[model samples]
Target chain A: MKARVHISLKTGVHDPQGKAIRNALSGLGFAGLGEVRQGKLIELELDETDPDTAREAVDRMCRGLLANPVIETYHIDLEA
Target chain B: MKARVHISLKTGVHDPQGKAIRNALSGLGFAGLGEVRQGKLIELELDETDPDTAREAVDRMCRGLLANPVIETYHIDLEA
Candidate 1:
């Protein structure tokens, strides 16, 4: 299976990288850009046999490796 | 409009972060997990009047700020 995992900083967490990008945009004359939130996208291939197994495996991957539970939230999309 | 910008390292460019993530997953007992490619996702609220304008704005943002064209590729998703 193929999975796309999106991991993002939880709301209320300050994102310096996102802010830096926003600032760069403003510097480049992109006005009226309200706010920017940056996250991580991970595309991976897994050998899980089924969607259920893939979900469980992906979730574990997110919690154990793909994300930092203290500050990040994650979602997964599985494609065969 | 709301836009999602995804920025990723170009192929052949080494991604240490992605490699670290893959290693972490393996360490956590996620076997059969193949290679991992990591990218950045930036969600922004913009004041563009239309999708075309938004696309133009985002492309500029990506080129002038959100992405390093030398090493990264970017895609945009616009929502009204």
Candidate 2:
């Protein structure tokens, strides 16, 4: 099974990297762009066959190291 | 409008970060894991209302700065 984790900053948290990207876009002539937020995507290939177990393990991975719960939120997608 | 860009490394490219994460997961006791790949998710808010325009602009952003085309591939998702 495979699990994909999408991690993004909480709504109220400031994202300096996003701001830099937004500015870069404008400088590159993409002036129509507005605000930008940056996040992470982690794709994991697991030996486990059960979707439930894989998701649970990946969820633990997210809470433990992949994300900072205070400022970021993560969602997991399991694939066979 | 909003556009989400998913940037991932091309197959066969070495990813030290992914390896490190995988090692860390094992250290944390998630030993059932196999391979892990990490990527970036960039969310953009655009001023354009037309989906076509927004996607085109975001696509340009991806080609220009959001992704390195040589070793990475990116997909854009446009949202109203």
Estimate the TM-score for candidate 2.
0.96
Q: Could you give candidate 1's per-residue lDDT for residues A1-77 as a string of tens digits?
A: 88988888998999998898788888877898988999999988887769998999889888876789999999898
Tens-digit lDDT track of model 2 for B14-36: 99999999999898888877889
Task: Assess the local accuracy of residue A7 in candidate 2 as a C-alpha lDDT between 0 and 100.
Answer: 97
**Ten residues in a row with the worst lDDT in model 2 chain A?**
A26-35
- Local distance difference test values of all predictions, in order: 0.87, 0.90
Report fnat, model 1. 0.87
Alpha carbon deviation, residue B73, candidate 2 (Å)? 0.5
The segments of candidate 1 whose C-alpha lies over 4 angstroms from its true place after superposition are none
Candidate 2 segments exceeding 4 Å error: none
- TM-scores of the models, in the given order? 0.91, 0.96
Whole-model alpha-carbon lDDT for candidate 1: 0.87
lDDT of 2 by residue, A1-80 (tens): 88989999999799999999888888887886677999999999999999888888888899999999999999998889
| Model 2 residue B64 CA deviation in Å | 0.7
